[model samples]
Structures are given as C-alpha cells and as structure tokens.
Target: MQLINYQMQRFWQYGGFNPDLYLFIPLSQTRYVTRGYNQVSQTWSPVLKKHSNVSEALFRVRATKAQSTLSRAQRKRNLKDAFSLSHCIQGKNIAIIDDVITTGSTMDAAAQTCLDAGAAKVWAFATSLTPLLGK
Candidate 1:
C-alpha cells in the first residue's frame, strides 16, 4: 500500500488534480476487526492528512473467496453482488488497492461496485501481477 499511496500522491501532484480521491479496500475474509501491523495504512495516514482531498480509504464492502483457486467463470460468479459499497463515490476518481492482480476479475468486480456507487473513474494500482495459480 505504501507504493500505491506514494503513486497516488505523485499522481495528485503531477497529474491533473481531481477534487476527490478515495482508496477502496476489500475487507478480510472474516470481520474480526483486528488491527494488525498495516504498513500501508500506517504510511498513508500522514499523507492523507497532508492532503485533505483524500476523502476516505474506507472498507465499505467485503469479498468472499481469496480468488486463488476459483475458475475464471467461478471467480466471476463468486463475486456477483458479493460486495457492496456503503459510501457515495459518485463522480470521483477512486484508486483500488490490492497486494496483487492476476486476472483482474476481483479488481473488476470491486471497481464495478465503486462505479455503480457513482464513481467516475476507477484506477487500479498493485504491487505485482503474477499470472501463476494462487496469485
């Protein structure tokens, strides 16, 4: 997430300044609400405060499986309405963050949710994209 947050800051600085920027995160497998060492969040807290334009990085939804073993069609089917956004992202440019991106179906579903919630543009930034199984 550090990489994504840094990229977002650079985009905001060098790229056209969009009025609103939101980070969308898919919730964990379970809702235990435990706070572990979130490196990305720790790095982003100060940066977000520095720029008030970052409205939120809220986890308004959850995803089912980890998307490692599901077939292509099953992955798509597994994510149908499996996620929902609680916040209004309409007309905003959102950046969805995940550790990796293989087929992009998971990210696609998540981004679709954001768009359906009114997001104008959804850009994905990830640390890596491995085509191997269990990615």
Candidate 2:
C-alpha cells in the first residue's frame, strides 16, 4: 500500500498526470495497523507538481461494516455520502485510482462525490478489481 501511494505521488512526472484529475484517497476508518504500509511524508517533486490537480478526501461519514462484510445494498448505503470533494471538479475527467475495487459501491460513492462537486465526468482506475468470478 505504501508503495502504491508512493507511485501515485510520483505519477505527476508522467505526462498522463494533470491538475484536472482529482486524486482522492480514502481514509482508513479503523485504527488497526496495516500489514505494511505508511502514509507518504515528504512530497516528491512530481507530487508537488500534481498538488494543484490532486487532492484528498476524508469522507467516511460513518463507520459501518467493511465492504467484505456487507451485502451489496448495505455496502452502497454504508458508503453513501462517505466522501466529499476538496476542489471544484466540474467539467473535468476525474480519475479515481484506488488499490482495489470490490462491490464498486465505494467507487460509486467517490464518483458521486465528484459529481456532486460539479465534475463533468468521472473515470475510475484500480490496481485490482474483484469480479464476480465463475458466476
């Protein structure tokens, strides 16, 4: 997770990274220690350059059951309004990059936040998206 965050922070060096993209990082509601991950401290040059475009959101309005533990409907309700946009994302193609995507409710909530914030469109990219395999 730490590595992922670092890479995300460094993405600014790549031409693909831009200010119009709002990078919202979901906060861990529980205090449980991650197996091996750390929040980035020093802002890399790329991160600094991307600062104008990137931002963080600490939504999670209320702590409910984790995605794995909740039913799809429950997950949707739990994550509803769980995030807030930090900047005006209107008329922008906001790409939400998360380490994983499960039921997609969380992503929906994130996208909803951007939409509510006036974003014209929302694109999501995840390191791993869990599909309902072998159904």
Candidate 3:
C-alpha cells in the first residue's frame, strides 16, 4: 500500500497528466465474490480520493478467463466487448488505472470502450509491467 501510494504521488507530481476523469479497471462480479475485494481499487483509490475526478464509471460486463492463463492473442480475444462505460464522457480526458500490465490487452479493451463512448483522450497507468509474454 505504501509503495502504490508513493508511486501515485510521483506520477501526480511528474507525469504531467491532469485528466478529467480517472477510472480503474474493475474486477468481474465472480472474481470479486471469490476474492472478497477488488485489490486494484483498494490499493489505488485512497491516494486518489482527494481528486473529485476519480470515478467508478467503467465496469466489466462479464467474467472471462484470467489473463495470466492466456497467450497474447488469447488475451485480446478474452477481453473483447468486456467493458462498458456507465456515463457519457464526451470530450473528456480519461485516465485508466490497473495494478499490473502484462499483454496490455485488458488496458486496450478498456481504453477502446472509453474512446467509443466519446472520451477525447485516454491514458493508462499501471504500477508494474511484465515483459511481453512471447518476447
């Protein structure tokens, strides 16, 4: 928790991004039920609570196979049409947060959904990135 808060502070200080809205990738209902919590929200949201723009508007529409168990191509397919926006954000700049980025398919899908909903721009921030799976 300390590490995530520190990283978020650094980004706010130096990342030069001031988004109109900040959205975190959400876990599906099934996963949240099994885990009893959404780790990403728990880790990232507290640091962002002072910012009024942080929102829970983006949501997973259905459960999919875990990305850790999939190949890059499969990862992309797994997240297709998996996300939706709950509000209209036309001409707004959005920032998406996640715990870790692996294949980037999850972020891509979420960003695409935001764009399709009329967000003028979208940025992705992750605490960590694993090497490309097939690299």
1 against 3, candidate with superior TM-score: 3
**Which of the two candidates, 2 or 3, achieves a greater lDDT against the reference?**
3
Q: After superposition, how far is residue 121 of candidate 2 from its true place, in Å?
A: 1.3
Which structure among the candidates has the greatest lDDT?
A: 3
| Candidate 2 Cα misplacement greater than 4 A, ranges | 1-19, 29-52, 132-135
Error of 1 at 126 (Å): 1.2
After TM-score superposition, the amount by which residue 54's alpha carbon in candidate 2 deviates from its true location, in angstroms, is: 2.4
TM-score per candidate = 0.69, 0.63, 0.90
Show how many residue pairs clash in every candidate, following the order shown: 1, 3, 0
Candidate 1, 1-135: lDDT as tens digits:
567567767877898745466463545535335545444444555546665655444453454775778777777877777667656766887766655677877788878888888888887766678884643
Candidate 2 worst ten-residue window by lDDT? 36-45
Order of candidate numbers by TM-score, starting with the best: 3, 1, 2
Worst 10 residues of 1 by lDDT: 31-40
